[model samples]
Target: MRGHPVTAMHPDHYESPAGLYLHIPFCVAKCGYCAFTSYPCGNAPPPDYLVALRQQAERLARHPMVREQRFATLFVGGGTPTVYGGAELGGLIRECLTLFNFDPEPEVTVEANPNSVELAKLAALREAGVNRLSIGVQSFSDRLLRGIDRSHSRAEALAAVAAARSAGFANLNLDLIYGLPEQSLADWRETIAVALAQNPEHLALYGLSVEEGTPFHRRSEQGGLALPDEETVQEMEDFAYGQLATAGLPRYEISNFARAGRSSRHNENYWHNGNYLGLGAAAVSCLGHLRFRQVPEPERFVRLINDGAPPFIEMEALPPAAAFRETVIMALRMLEGIAVAELAARFGVTPQDYYGKTFVRLQAQGLLAVEDGFLRLTARALPVANQVLAELV
Candidate 1:
């Protein structure tokens, strides 16, 4: 069973960058539709959180496997990493650099929300060697922002982009959300237009999913949430594909668009099933066949680290076959899809060997296609890609 824990490491794995991910759990406030592991901390994280993080990083750095690896990318993400002052976040990155072996030109990225960022802070981050900025600008509509309980306004989002450029960040990514309650197709189109005016290097567009425990989910249960109809939502996605491509930002993945040479290397490593080390509360890591996550509660995580104990709350191992299956699924997320022969050579198993029947079935159904040497979803499956990919899993 996929859920059963195993202990063997796969012989062959991804030949891509080893990335590092640091999670910050504090946020100004939770979004109505957010389900991520985050807490509502007023302005910044508790003083002890960074201490615990530093302790955990120092402990992980001494492991034989970790010490031998050189990281190619580092991403500081969270509820909002910008909540910490630029100097504080930069200090954390500088410490990680000394503790870990990073590539000469590693891509260092930090996630921020417009409301929590300012020019001085951004400049400090740039000075600390952060080369990339990913700002959460869900929409440029004050009405939409309020509807989702977002703290930032349209003006703040625009200012954030200008500030990032002024701070000397050449690589930047902006996130936008669609299918919000009471959002019309016109509204989505306007948001995309506003985002394009910033000319960011990358754009991550996501459709809203109301998960359990989110305010949106409860509102939905009570039949109070108003969302665009399915057809309208599909049209919005199609429009974005054409619009962004026309703007020289082509779709590389289902939810991501980027200018040439600006795709997120950290996220690409993930899509390629490469190894990464994660730190901080609720952070997840995948090494060889071992996968685990830190304790979700920030307080408990800090206690564990302070007490010199592992903070992991969940751990699982993936057998080779299971790992290969996962690689295919994650690869399918990229528009380029999977290189059939290359993966087969690397894993010593063809897609046919593991999923021949499923492949034939989906291919016959027009949801998948093998073109040239790659196996990818068909154009017909792009809109319903999630459903099509789930069938393989």
Candidate 2:
């Protein structure tokens, strides 16, 4: 009787091998640019949080089909995954692995902030089987770091890579941001140069977008903060996109680049519309056409999970039409673009029937091209990608 409910949730819905995303919603100091749900450093999660986490996983495993499923990728991200220090983190990782079936060579990634990286801790994570590190080095300039409220120093961010290398982590990705309030094109070039000099396996470059409700947004609305004009921002992206591609880290997606074989498998799961399950407060999970997310408030999430539930605000089962639209939306985000056959299989509709008009219009505008069974956005249309995507939506 206890196992009956797990079987009824329908394992066929998660037909594809799933990916696991463990959100560590704890941070040292919140960055001005961040909007993720995370508690501050001093406010660590309650000590027994792991027991609740294990409970949730245990429940998931009780589901008949889920019991046998293995994850293709495992991503540990969040409010600075290293904020709790190594011992706590190691326990969480071990518990997760013990609870779920993992791929033979799952791409294991942990997001780290330079401020929290100690050589010993990094080595511990490595020894505990973390093969990839995604370091947040928002800027190499101390001036920009301070302006953005980043807790790490320029030296610390720089030294993190060296430290990771010393600890034997080769699959490293650096995160950089552009379009600062007082940054110049030359400064951006220098930033890019410094990042390239590190010879990272992958890099992610994000334009500074002040989301509504963020401190940056409020200040900008009050006219106290100045942002670069749209034209300047576009030019900045164009410069970086071209420069990075030329430097051999060609843009795989709009803002992400990888050196040869180092693309983030976890992120690719997102843009490619693959199956992924998220844990931790406010983390979202997508299985088949059903999407669910934990309540963003950490305490609330813990309470719900403690009550023997998934801690989500709601479980929304997307209709086939909605799912088709989403597939088109996410697929267009990739440089490899959407495959006709995959879309057809997922949506039960012909790509031509579903997106014929938008495809023709985009192609006539020289912004996209449809090849044998695939449709991809051209480099020219990438900066104005939203405009192109809106037509299909």
Candidate 3:
């Protein structure tokens, strides 16, 4: 079954997730700004890690919730999923498919670093049913790429895209980062121009965030980082929006742009607050009112899975209020905004009733607006979304 067959109940009452996320925590080299739970694995992933992943998939497949579910999207994201051999990665995908009842046209996506991807790997992944490729082309400037300690050169980034095209990957997303230290507006503009030249199906543009414990954070604390000024960063964002729109890739979410009908289904599921099962080291899963997070350390993850025990380090059953807040926060990230009636139906409380005066005040400040029946951030409010969203919580 593609999904649980519905009875006479309203469709909204039968909400079930159709998405899955697999985390690959192995990387050739950790980027300076990255704080994700990933570590260097040199030439290839540890063989044991693959075995653990398969075990985890098999265990989850037997779970009652998983058995009742039919996934329509499977996203293999990572610290560089391409670090594993193509055949190995394909085998993992096949294993997941066998363990889960996936849709015939499920959107399977894999993340790759430009330095590790090749024509052979791309072909292997394509043959394995991966229809989309999201390449980590963080910057087109060689100097900026080095500043972030990225392993891929600008040439390698371009070559990776060319190879994916040759391998018949028509759906591709190039990830770009702005607000890097020493990144000028012109540098960002040139990066956008080069990325647009490739005509990717999607673009994920994110501003650099100096997370604590990362190398970038340490450098900033030591007064060594020279990040662009706030005004310049805002200009860079505006420029990207304009340039991407002109290239026919319009912004569907705050940080993502896509060609018509090409937006990431897996990501959209997240934005809609849909349920998803995540597997592998440090993976997170959200089903119904409960959320679970796996152990961050790969070795520990493998040990627990091999021992036939749950690898989760933490599990929480969200209170109603907390779930409502999370749903609103995620839904607001989309340009389309959230339907107030739907939100009320899902949460058992209208946004205005819950947020009360703060909601009205934000609307009065022109930071938020209610058009038709939807509540959304205004254009001026998007740049300061964190501040605006904080008010609700």
Cα lDDT of model 2 by residue, 106-127, tens digit: 7888899997888988888887
Top lDDT hit: 3
Instruction: Look at candidate 2 and give me any clashing residue pairs.
Output: none
What is the TM-score of candidate 2?
0.92
> Model 3: per-residue lDDT, tens digit, 228-294?
9999999999999999999999998999999999999999988877778999999999887689999
lDDT of 2 at 55: 67
TM-score of each: 0.96, 0.92, 0.95
Score each candidate by Cα lDDT. 0.88, 0.78, 0.89
Candidate 1 local accuracy as lDDT? 0.88
Candidate 2: list runs displaced more than 4 Å. Answer: 1-16, 43-46
Poorest 10 consecutive residues by lDDT, candidate 1: 1-10
Ranking by lDDT: 3, 1, 2
Off by over 4 Å in 3: 1-16
- The CA-based lDDT of model 3 is what? 0.89
Worst 10 residues of 2 by lDDT: 1-10
Arranged by TM-score, best first: 1, 3, 2
